[model samples]
Target: MKNVILTQEAPAAIGPYSQAIEANGMIYTSGQLPIDPATGEMPKDVEAQAEQSLKNVFAILKEAGVDGSNVIKTTVFIKDMGDFPKINKVYETFFTESYPARSCVEVARLPKDALVEIEVIASNNKTNIK
Candidate 1:
Protein backbone atom coordinates (compact mmCIF):
# COMPACT_ATOMS: atom_id res chain seq x y z
CA MET A 1 0.00 0.00 0.00
CA LYS A 2 1.08 3.58 -0.61
CA ASN A 3 0.34 6.49 1.68
CA VAL A 4 0.83 10.20 1.14
CA ILE A 5 1.98 12.36 4.02
CA LEU A 6 1.50 16.08 4.55
CA THR A 7 2.03 18.46 7.41
CA GLN A 8 1.63 22.16 8.12
CA GLU A 9 4.76 22.06 10.26
CA ALA A 10 6.69 22.04 6.99
CA PRO A 11 6.27 24.54 4.22
CA ALA A 12 3.50 23.73 1.79
CA ALA A 13 4.68 22.39 -1.51
CA ILE A 14 4.90 25.15 -4.06
CA GLY A 15 4.18 22.70 -6.84
CA PRO A 16 2.28 19.52 -7.50
CA TYR A 17 3.69 16.99 -5.08
CA SER A 18 3.04 15.65 -1.64
CA GLN A 19 5.53 16.38 1.12
CA ALA A 20 6.25 12.68 1.49
CA ILE A 21 5.02 9.25 0.57
CA GLU A 22 5.08 6.17 2.77
CA ALA A 23 5.09 2.87 0.97
CA ASN A 24 5.99 -0.63 2.03
CA GLY A 25 7.59 0.63 5.25
CA MET A 26 9.71 3.35 3.77
CA ILE A 27 9.16 7.08 3.71
CA TYR A 28 10.49 9.21 0.84
CA THR A 29 10.42 12.95 1.25
CA SER A 30 10.60 15.75 -1.26
CA GLY A 31 13.52 18.16 -1.31
CA GLN A 32 13.11 20.63 1.50
CA LEU A 33 14.25 24.22 1.24
CA PRO A 34 15.03 26.71 4.01
CA ILE A 35 11.65 28.37 3.87
CA ASP A 36 10.49 28.76 7.45
CA PRO A 37 7.06 27.16 7.74
CA ALA A 38 5.83 29.84 10.10
CA THR A 39 6.87 32.83 8.03
CA GLY A 40 7.71 31.35 4.60
CA GLU A 41 10.99 33.20 4.67
CA MET A 42 14.42 31.88 3.83
CA PRO A 43 17.23 32.44 6.29
CA LYS A 44 20.14 34.63 5.23
CA ASP A 45 23.12 32.56 6.35
CA VAL A 46 24.09 29.08 5.18
CA GLU A 47 24.13 27.64 8.69
CA ALA A 48 20.70 28.97 9.51
CA GLN A 49 19.41 27.88 6.13
CA ALA A 50 20.81 24.40 6.60
CA GLU A 51 19.21 24.15 10.03
CA GLN A 52 15.86 25.21 8.69
CA SER A 53 16.11 22.75 5.82
CA LEU A 54 16.76 19.91 8.22
CA LYS A 55 13.90 21.07 10.40
CA ASN A 56 11.66 20.90 7.36
CA VAL A 57 12.86 17.40 6.62
CA PHE A 58 12.22 16.40 10.22
CA ALA A 59 8.72 17.77 10.08
CA ILE A 60 7.93 15.60 7.07
CA LEU A 61 9.43 12.60 8.79
CA LYS A 62 7.31 13.22 11.87
CA GLU A 63 4.21 13.36 9.69
CA ALA A 64 5.14 9.92 8.42
CA GLY A 65 5.46 8.69 11.98
CA VAL A 66 9.22 8.34 11.72
CA ASP A 67 12.19 10.16 13.20
CA GLY A 68 15.71 11.21 12.30
CA SER A 69 17.16 7.90 13.53
CA ASN A 70 14.96 6.11 11.03
CA VAL A 71 16.53 7.85 8.08
CA ILE A 72 18.53 5.48 5.90
CA LYS A 73 19.84 7.95 3.38
CA THR A 74 19.85 11.61 2.45
CA THR A 75 20.87 13.80 -0.46
CA VAL A 76 21.85 17.44 -0.09
CA PHE A 77 21.98 20.00 -2.86
CA ILE A 78 23.87 23.23 -2.42
CA LYS A 79 24.15 26.10 -4.81
CA ASP A 80 27.82 26.52 -3.90
CA MET A 81 30.34 23.95 -2.80
CA GLY A 82 31.97 26.57 -0.59
CA ASP A 83 29.08 26.23 1.83
CA PHE A 84 29.56 22.50 2.44
CA PRO A 85 31.37 22.87 5.75
CA LYS A 86 28.79 25.24 7.12
CA ILE A 87 25.96 23.01 5.99
CA ASN A 88 27.70 19.92 7.33
CA LYS A 89 28.11 21.46 10.75
CA VAL A 90 24.37 22.00 11.08
CA TYR A 91 23.57 18.64 9.49
CA GLU A 92 25.77 16.81 11.98
CA THR A 93 23.83 18.22 14.89
CA PHE A 94 20.78 16.22 13.84
CA PHE A 95 22.12 12.66 13.71
CA THR A 96 24.20 10.60 16.11
CA GLU A 97 26.43 7.47 15.93
CA SER A 98 24.32 5.57 13.41
CA TYR A 99 24.29 8.25 10.84
CA PRO A 100 22.37 7.77 7.63
CA ALA A 101 24.22 7.43 4.34
CA ARG A 102 24.41 10.78 2.48
CA SER A 103 25.50 12.52 -0.66
CA CYS A 104 26.10 16.23 -1.10
CA VAL A 105 26.45 17.94 -4.42
CA GLU A 106 26.69 21.44 -5.76
CA VAL A 107 24.16 22.48 -8.32
CA ALA A 108 24.24 25.46 -10.64
CA ARG A 109 21.03 26.69 -9.11
CA LEU A 110 17.91 25.56 -7.33
CA PRO A 111 14.25 26.39 -7.20
CA LYS A 112 13.74 29.88 -5.75
CA ASP A 113 17.55 30.29 -5.79
CA ALA A 114 17.73 28.78 -2.34
CA LEU A 115 21.17 28.15 -0.92
CA VAL A 116 20.49 24.57 0.15
CA GLU A 117 17.96 21.81 -0.19
CA ILE A 118 17.70 18.40 1.46
CA GLU A 119 15.70 15.27 0.78
CA VAL A 120 15.59 12.05 2.79
CA ILE A 121 14.46 8.43 2.88
CA ALA A 122 13.57 6.63 6.09
CA SER A 123 12.42 3.18 7.12
CA ASN A 124 10.00 2.16 9.81
CA ASN A 125 12.33 -0.50 11.31
CA LYS A 126 9.28 -2.65 11.74
CA THR A 127 9.26 -5.08 8.86
CA ASN A 128 5.90 -6.62 9.68
CA ILE A 129 3.99 -3.42 10.30
CA LYS A 130 3.85 -1.72 6.96
Candidate 2:
Protein backbone atom coordinates (compact mmCIF):
# COMPACT_ATOMS: atom_id res chain seq x y z
CA MET A 1 0.00 0.00 0.00
CA LYS A 2 1.05 3.60 -0.67
CA ASN A 3 1.26 6.09 2.16
CA VAL A 4 1.09 9.85 1.97
CA ILE A 5 3.63 11.55 4.21
CA LEU A 6 3.00 14.81 6.03
CA THR A 7 4.80 16.68 8.77
CA GLN A 8 4.46 20.10 10.39
CA GLU A 9 8.24 20.30 10.42
CA ALA A 10 8.11 21.01 6.71
CA PRO A 11 6.29 23.65 4.78
CA ALA A 12 2.82 22.74 3.64
CA ALA A 13 2.54 21.84 0.01
CA ILE A 14 1.70 24.85 -2.10
CA GLY A 15 -0.53 22.87 -4.44
CA PRO A 16 -2.58 19.74 -4.63
CA TYR A 17 0.15 17.29 -3.76
CA SER A 18 1.33 15.41 -0.74
CA GLN A 19 4.73 16.34 0.65
CA ALA A 20 5.84 12.84 -0.16
CA ILE A 21 4.56 9.34 -0.80
CA GLU A 22 5.88 5.94 0.17
CA ALA A 23 5.34 2.52 -1.35
CA ASN A 24 7.26 -0.69 -1.68
CA GLY A 25 9.92 0.51 0.71
CA MET A 26 10.63 3.54 -1.40
CA ILE A 27 9.87 7.16 -0.62
CA TYR A 28 9.52 9.87 -3.23
CA THR A 29 9.42 13.52 -2.34
CA SER A 30 8.10 16.43 -4.31
CA GLY A 31 10.44 19.28 -5.17
CA GLN A 32 10.96 21.37 -2.09
CA LEU A 33 11.18 25.13 -2.37
CA PRO A 34 13.22 27.13 0.17
CA ILE A 35 10.21 28.46 2.00
CA ASP A 36 10.53 28.18 5.78
CA PRO A 37 7.62 26.38 7.40
CA ALA A 38 7.37 28.81 10.27
CA THR A 39 8.08 32.03 8.40
CA GLY A 40 6.59 31.10 5.03
CA GLU A 41 9.53 32.93 3.49
CA MET A 42 12.34 31.96 1.20
CA PRO A 43 15.89 32.74 2.23
CA LYS A 44 17.57 35.54 0.27
CA ASP A 45 20.84 33.83 -0.61
CA VAL A 46 21.64 30.80 -2.70
CA GLU A 47 23.58 28.96 0.02
CA ALA A 48 20.87 29.51 2.58
CA GLN A 49 18.26 28.57 0.02
CA ALA A 50 20.04 25.32 -0.72
CA GLU A 51 20.25 24.47 2.97
CA GLN A 52 16.58 25.21 3.49
CA SER A 53 15.68 23.08 0.51
CA LEU A 54 17.73 20.17 1.88
CA LYS A 55 16.16 20.60 5.29
CA ASN A 56 12.74 20.46 3.70
CA VAL A 57 13.61 17.34 1.74
CA PHE A 58 15.01 15.62 4.80
CA ALA A 59 11.96 16.55 6.83
CA ILE A 60 9.81 14.63 4.41
CA LEU A 61 12.27 11.76 4.46
CA LYS A 62 12.19 11.77 8.25
CA GLU A 63 8.42 11.61 8.15
CA ALA A 64 8.74 8.59 5.89
CA GLY A 65 11.06 7.01 8.48
CA VAL A 66 14.36 7.48 6.70
CA ASP A 67 17.43 9.67 6.77
CA GLY A 68 19.86 11.29 4.38
CA SER A 69 21.85 8.10 4.01
CA ASN A 70 18.74 6.41 2.67
CA VAL A 71 18.52 8.76 -0.28
CA ILE A 72 19.28 7.05 -3.52
CA LYS A 73 18.82 9.96 -5.86
CA THR A 74 18.52 13.71 -5.81
CA THR A 75 17.38 16.40 -8.23
CA VAL A 76 18.22 20.01 -7.69
CA PHE A 77 16.89 23.00 -9.63
CA ILE A 78 18.57 26.34 -9.50
CA LYS A 79 17.70 29.72 -10.90
CA ASP A 80 21.31 30.33 -11.93
CA MET A 81 24.17 28.02 -12.78
CA GLY A 82 26.60 30.61 -11.53
CA ASP A 83 25.52 29.90 -7.97
CA PHE A 84 26.31 26.21 -8.25
CA PRO A 85 29.44 26.49 -6.12
CA LYS A 86 27.60 28.12 -3.26
CA ILE A 87 24.76 25.67 -3.48
CA ASN A 88 27.14 22.74 -3.64
CA LYS A 89 28.89 23.80 -0.48
CA VAL A 90 25.64 23.88 1.42
CA TYR A 91 24.49 20.64 -0.16
CA GLU A 92 27.66 18.94 1.11
CA THR A 93 26.62 19.36 4.72
CA PHE A 94 23.47 17.26 4.43
CA PHE A 95 24.74 14.02 2.94
CA THR A 96 27.52 12.83 5.17
CA GLU A 97 28.13 9.09 5.02
CA SER A 98 27.23 8.33 1.42
CA TYR A 99 26.49 10.36 -1.64
CA PRO A 100 23.47 9.71 -3.76
CA ALA A 101 23.23 10.01 -7.54
CA ARG A 102 22.33 13.60 -8.29
CA SER A 103 21.21 15.72 -11.19
CA CYS A 104 21.20 19.48 -11.02
CA VAL A 105 20.10 22.00 -13.59
CA GLU A 106 19.58 25.67 -14.07
CA VAL A 107 16.06 26.88 -14.66
CA ALA A 108 14.58 30.10 -15.86
CA ARG A 109 12.52 30.38 -12.71
CA LEU A 110 11.22 28.50 -9.74
CA PRO A 111 8.16 28.52 -7.52
CA LYS A 112 8.15 31.66 -5.34
CA ASP A 113 11.28 32.66 -7.23
CA ALA A 114 13.30 30.44 -4.93
CA LEU A 115 17.00 30.35 -5.64
CA VAL A 116 17.15 26.60 -5.20
CA GLU A 117 14.80 23.66 -4.99
CA ILE A 118 15.45 20.01 -4.15
CA GLU A 119 13.72 16.65 -4.15
CA VAL A 120 14.86 13.15 -3.34
CA ILE A 121 14.07 9.47 -3.66
CA ALA A 122 15.01 7.28 -0.73
CA SER A 123 15.04 3.67 0.38
CA ASN A 124 12.85 3.12 3.38
CA ASN A 125 14.41 -0.11 4.51
CA LYS A 126 15.88 -1.63 7.65
CA THR A 127 19.48 -1.18 6.52
CA ASN A 128 19.00 2.53 5.97
CA ILE A 129 19.27 3.49 9.66
CA LYS A 130 16.33 5.80 10.00
lDDT tens digits, residues 8-105, model 2? 98999999999999989889999999989999988898999999999999888888878898999999999999999999999998987668999999
Residue lDDT tens for model 1, 39-72:
9999988899899999999999887777898999
TM-score of each: 0.94, 0.95
Task: Give residue 28's lDDT in candidate 2 (0 to 100).
Answer: 93
**TM-score, model 1 to reference:** 0.94
Which candidate gets the maximum TM-score versus the true structure?
2
Q: Mark the 10 consecutive residues where model 1 has the least summed lDDT.
A: 121-130
What lDDT does the true structure give each of the candidates?
Answer: 0.91, 0.90
